[model samples]
Target: MSIYIFDGTMTGLLSCIFRAFQFKEFDVQVSTDANVQTGLFAEVIDVASNDEHAQRVWQGLKLKASDSAFKQFYYAFLSEQQQAFQHCFNFAIYVFQQQRDVSKNYGHADVLGMSQWAKQVGREKHRMEAFVRFKKCQDGLFISLVSPDFNVLPIIERHFKARYQDQRWLIYDEKRNFGIYYDLHKVHQVQMDAGAIDRQTASGHSQSFCIELDDEEVLYDQLWKDYFRSVNIEARRNMKLHVQYVPRRYWRYMNEKTL
Candidate 1:
């Protein structure tokens, strides 16, 4: 038995996949920076991230597997579950060895596992599109914050870009402490320290944030609340159904939820 430790990047996982196939390491388990497990009879191997090697593996998969299968593998990786790395690896093994479409092969545990995770990731991706509420900044930037279960910003950005192409926007993941910014032309990823941001926006700071919604923004907020209040039918109100769909975890980012 063998264990592979990777840097937790997709490239590192792909590089580990390359080594797994090259060395015929069938009885193998993969671990990322976040999850490393031990086995009594396992030999540990540290895998380096190699972009070229990873790209080769990806290109091979492009030829051998369905487009949806790659998404499943990617979504499984984003799952960040303890066994997700190994699940992705086993799915790859089936694809490489079988050289046929095995996406519906529920008889294989790994295939089923990847599909389940992919479904979860896809659900979150769609939910993000529905739940995201952006605040307009003083400098004309639209800022939204979220802490999704999976890394869904990658998938959700496409929708925002397509819908609001003329606007500058930033989607920040408070948990991840990184954001995706979209200018008129392209999207860029940015990183920030939570402590630094807190200090910068502290009471003594020159400018305020979060609380800095100007008068116009405050009016917009009121307008939204008033609209919802006018349309809300007390007789039809269902708190259970509302919470079931929107979820309490995401309520902080919603505008009308504040009302």
Candidate 2:
């Protein structure tokens, strides 16, 4: 058994495929360097990420794979699960070994696994786009904090960038400790200083940012809450149906949910 260790990047993953084919090492297992596990008898190989090698494998996959298969490969990778990486590794190898498109071969575990994982990641991306609510800061920047189930900040970037093109905004993923900043023109990945803000406060459900909110933004929040309150019909309330559509985990992002 051969174990291939990579740097946990899309390029690194493609590089792994390139090496696997280059050496004709068919029996293999894939893992990121950050979370590598090995068997005592297994032969372990460390893979270095190379753009040229990655691009070659990427171009090859694109030529052989159907459009849906190509998209499924990327979305599955974004899932960030160790099992998903293994499925991607196996799925790519299967694609290269076959002459026909095998994307719909649900009987094959790897193909089905990749499709299922992609759907889960895709669902999270849509939920983040719907639930994210930006709070206006004193400096005129809109900021929102999210802790999604999957690593979806990259996937949600285009949606926010297109929708809020004229304004500057930052959507930070507290779980991952990183954020994306949109300056009227482009979006950039960012990180905040450890002591830059307090993550929690006495009221456990507050935004708790170190920065101050604009006075008008606070008033706008209150008015929005009042509007929300006025529209409620206690008799028609359906907790089960509401919770199904708007999960409890995302309540913190909605202004009306805050006290």
TM-score list, all predictions: 0.91, 0.94
- In angstroms, the error of model 1 at 172 is 0.6
Give candidate 1 regions above 4 Å deviation.
33-37, 196-212
TM-score of candidate 2 on Cα atoms, chains taken together: 0.94
Q: What does candidate 2 score in Cα RMSD to the true structure?
A: 1.7
**Where does model 2 exceed 4 Å of error?**
33-35
lDDT of 1 by residue, 172-210 (tens): 887778899999999999886654433123323122244
- Per-model C-alpha lDDT, please? 0.80, 0.89
lDDT of 2 by residue, 1-259 (tens): 8888898899999999999999998789998864566788988888999999999999998998888988988999998888999999999999999998886788999999999999999999999999898889999999988888989999899999999999999999888899999999999999987367665566656566788988798888889989999999989999999999999888888888887
Clashing pairs in model 2, backbone N/Cα/C closer than 3 A: none
lDDT for model 1 comes to 0.80
